[model samples]
Target: MSIEELNQELTRLRQCLQQLKTDNAELRQAVLEYTTQLKQHKSEQQAALLERQRIEEQLQTTQQFLYSVIQTMPVAVFVKDVVDLRIVLCNQAAEKLAGVSADEILGKNDYDLFPREEADFFTTRDREALNSKKLLEIPEEIIRTKSGETRILQIKKAPILDSQGQPKYLLVVRYDITEHKQAEAQLKQQAIELEQTLKELQSTQAQLIQSEKMSSLGQLVAGVAHEINNPVNFISGNLTYANKYIQQLLNLLHLYRINYPNPAQEIQMTIQEMEFDFLVEDLLKLLSSMEIGAERIQQIVVSLRIFSRLDEAELKAVDIHQGIESTLSILEHRLKPRANHVEIQVLKDYDDLPLVECYAGQLNQVFMNILSNAIDALEEALIQGKLSHNHPQIRICTQQLNAQQIVIRIIDNGLGIPEQVKQKLFDPFFTTKDVGKGTGLGLSISYQIITERHGGSLECVSSLEEGAELIITIPVVQPKQ
Candidate 1:
């Protein structure tokens, strides 16, 4: 019994040992698996920490770069909180513009930094920018610094957006523009002064040229009139006597014919062959024609003298109509028909006017210029086939405008001047004619004569295809210097 029991106990003991070995093996495997899992978790934690550190460094670098950009800009830059419109960030330029330190400017609202009116304006603009989420530009604004100095500025405001596309802050930029504005104004003033000086120089030049021209013309005309006057006086004086002698001779012949009714055959044949009766009538007719021609020559000589007016240099009361007629006489040849061109007819409407106090010779010269220009316009119309009326004509009208003033108007039926061309018509050296055909100073000088020399006004009215009218108004008595 002891042996059997011993053998059974030994087998049980071996089985139990085997069971314990299996359990120990399973326990070792579980411990190894737990150790491997713990190592993997620790590695994952380390990688996450490294990535977080790297992100923090990148964020710091980006902030530094943005700050540097804002600090170095030339313009005054400010950043404000969207909620309270309070300034959160400012650059050195902003501090200088405000004439204050950054410590005082930071975390302050516009109301605290500026006057009430300026603050209101700034706040309104900030709100508008934030609400619209767009950039706003102000072309100009006035700002008073801490030193009480006024300055002009151009400003721009923009809303900074966040990741969710919402406004986070307001950014403002301002540029000083006072000096630029002042320079622009100075340039404009200088330009005006230069233009005035140019006008004065041109006027002086015109006066000199016209004076020389008028003097030369006067000398030549005076000489011609003197020469013609002597001849015309002699011829006119002799024609009267010759006419009387012819009448006496005809009376003597009549007496002989009455007294010697019966004559010798030879004498009667002579009288018949000579046609004595017809000869007597024809001779009287010839004498009458000679007298008329002599008178016409005398009148022409007088007209020439009047037109010269070399001695009438000072202002004097003159017959305006006589001066006009003299100018027409001088330009008669130009008014006549030319090759392939019709005659230019002139119509006059005269009013009763008193003698005007003016320089006679100078006034005549003005008349000559205006009339010549009218003729040129008519001729140009004919050349270009732009004449509205078949008969190219000039109309001259005169009237007393008031008790102290008189007006004259010269109108033409021709191709009218364009508005653009008419504006510069009175300028010196401005002309529509060929370079050689015109000096281009005639109208300019005429304008000076009427306005500056005689204290008058000259105006031109014209339209395209509707002809032109030039009007002149002058005082009857000039103002005393």
Candidate 2:
């Protein structure tokens, strides 16, 4: 009985052991499957983590690129919250314009950054942009930096909207235009100066032309004067000789008539037919008249020669008073009373002066022109009823200024020039006289002659309703040309 039971128990034990072995094998297989699954899961998790990290790096790079673009932009860029109106974003250019770093300007409002007036203006514009909910452009806006530098800006303000289409921020972009404005202003000033220079050149060109014409005219007058001088001198000399010869003949005839009371019958008949007594007395008078006419012709020839001074080509030391006298003598008729007006009184106050070294011919011409102008002025005053207090007068005064200079003042009582006109008195082709009456070159030419030719100054002092005084200052010793 023991052997059978033992065998049975052993059989059961073998079966159990076999089952346990099978279970152990199954458990090992399960564990291997679980290890493979665990490794796969861990690999999948690592791949997901890498993808997430790559995505994060891309996002960071994109943000940095946007920041770099904003910082490097030429124009100043600023972002302000639409609700609180506080600066939220400031670019490098914005910081530069604000004269501060980004940290100093990032969270500041216009009121916090700018003056009260500028802040008010900027905020008002920002509000308008926000209200408009669109881009707003300001053509020009002035901004003062913390460094006290002023700049003009072209501003573009736009509202940044959220996904819900509501304004979230105001984006302000501004371009500085200070340098551009300054360049424009400089260009304008240069243009003005260039125009003035062009005007001066034109005036000088016209003056040169006028001087050439005057030189030609002077040559012609000089030639005419020379031609008249020779003939007038011959005539004057012959007339004097003829007058003396006639006087001698008359005396001899009177002596003969007294000695031989009874004359020839033919001579007495001729005398009686010719009204002898009346002819005798009239003959003497006629001879005297002829002599006087010859003398007057000689004087006119002298005056014309003096006025022209054609022979005096180079500079010479001469008396200034003589030059004035020659000019007055040449213009005596103009000064004398005409059928319509009274004679203009000329007063001379001449100092005892040394002989001035000058071009005598040109000096005489200057004196003539000045005296002629004076006469014209006096005549104009008389005609215009400006000589109410007294008659027209021209006073010419010569003074020895210093060892080096001389002064000649020609004063005239006349209707004077306006202040505005006086400033332009020396400009070529500028005149107050009528178009035909004045070439507008007399005073201009005179000024040129005195200033350029003689190194002198010709100045006029006058105002409306006041008399004019033309003071000429010249160096006594002429500078070598």
Candidate 3:
């Protein structure tokens, strides 16, 4: 009985021990799984911590880069709070421009750093910029620095907007432009001075050339007149005496013929062969023709001498119409009809003007230049078919404008000058003629002679498809020098 009971207890104990061993194994597995889960969780936490650190470091680097950019910018840069309009940030350039240190400039309002008027202007602009939420540019502004130095600045203001589309700050950039403006003004002044100097040089050169030309022309014409006068005088003096002597011989021969009517046959035959009656008539006519030719030569010589006016150096009262007639005589060959060109007719309406006190030779030169140009213009018009149906004509009219002044107008019916060309007509070296056809100084010299030398005004009036008229007004009597 004792052995069976003991064995039953032992079995129960064994069952309990087996259950305990199973529970211990399950507990160990649970602990291993928990340790693995805890390691994984820790690894994930470490990675997240590293990512956060990297992001913070990158953000710090970006901030430093931006700060460097703002400080080193050349233009004066300022950042002001939108609400208070107080400068919160400024670059090194701004401090220098304001003539103050960053420590003194930062966190200061415009009123604190500038005059009341300037402060008001700056604040008004800042507010406008913020309200507009766009960039505003002021082309020019003047500001005085702390050191009392004045500066011109071009300013640009822009609003810094936040993500919510609201103005956060006002950014101001100013560029100094004082030096540029000064240089521009200096260059402009220099350009004006240079243009004046060039014009003076041109005028001087034209004067020298014209003076030499007139001197040479006068010498040549005087020489020609002298050379022709002697021969013409000789021929003219001899023709009269020869005509009288021949008439005396013819009268004596008529008496001989009458008294010796019953002369020898040989004498009669010789008289008939000689045609004595026709010979007497023809000889008189030939002598008359020679005298006329001699007179024409003398008139030409006179015209040449008058045109040259070599002796009239000093100012003298002279007939203006005489000068005009001499010029026409010199240009007579050109006015006549030529190959493929019609005659250029000249009409003169000259008033009985009082004698004008002037340099006679110079006045003649002006007439020559004006008439020559008119002839050229008429020829040009004919060549261009502008005067196809109408003949080319030039009309010259003179009048007494007032007690002291006189007016002379030269008009031409030709291809009229364009407004643009006519505006520069009297300018030196300006020409409408082809290269080598003109010297381009004729009208310019004439204008100078009338306006500067004679104290007058010269102007042209013309329009397209119409004729051109050049009016010259001068005082009749020379003013005391």
TM-score against native, each model: 0.68, 0.66, 0.70
Ranking by TM-score: 3, 1, 2
**Candidate 2 lDDT by residue in tens digits, 25-129:** 999999999999999999999999999999999999999999999989999999899777898998888988999998898778998889999999999999999
Using TM-score, give the best candidate's number: 3
Lowest lDDT block of 10, candidate 3: 381-390
Task: Look at candidate 3 and tell me the lDDT of residue 79.
Answer: 93
Q: Alpha-carbon error at 440 in model 2, in Å?
A: 2.3
Tens-place lDDT digits, model 3, residues 16-103: 9999999999989998888988898899889889988999999999989998999999889999998788899999999989999999
lDDT of every model, 2 decimals: 0.88, 0.85, 0.88
Those runs of model 1 whose alpha carbons end farther than 4 Å from true positions after fitting are 1-75, 80-86, 91-172, 239-297
Backbone clash pairs for candidate 2 read none
Residue pairs in steric clash, candidate 1?
none
- Residue pairs in collision within model 3: none
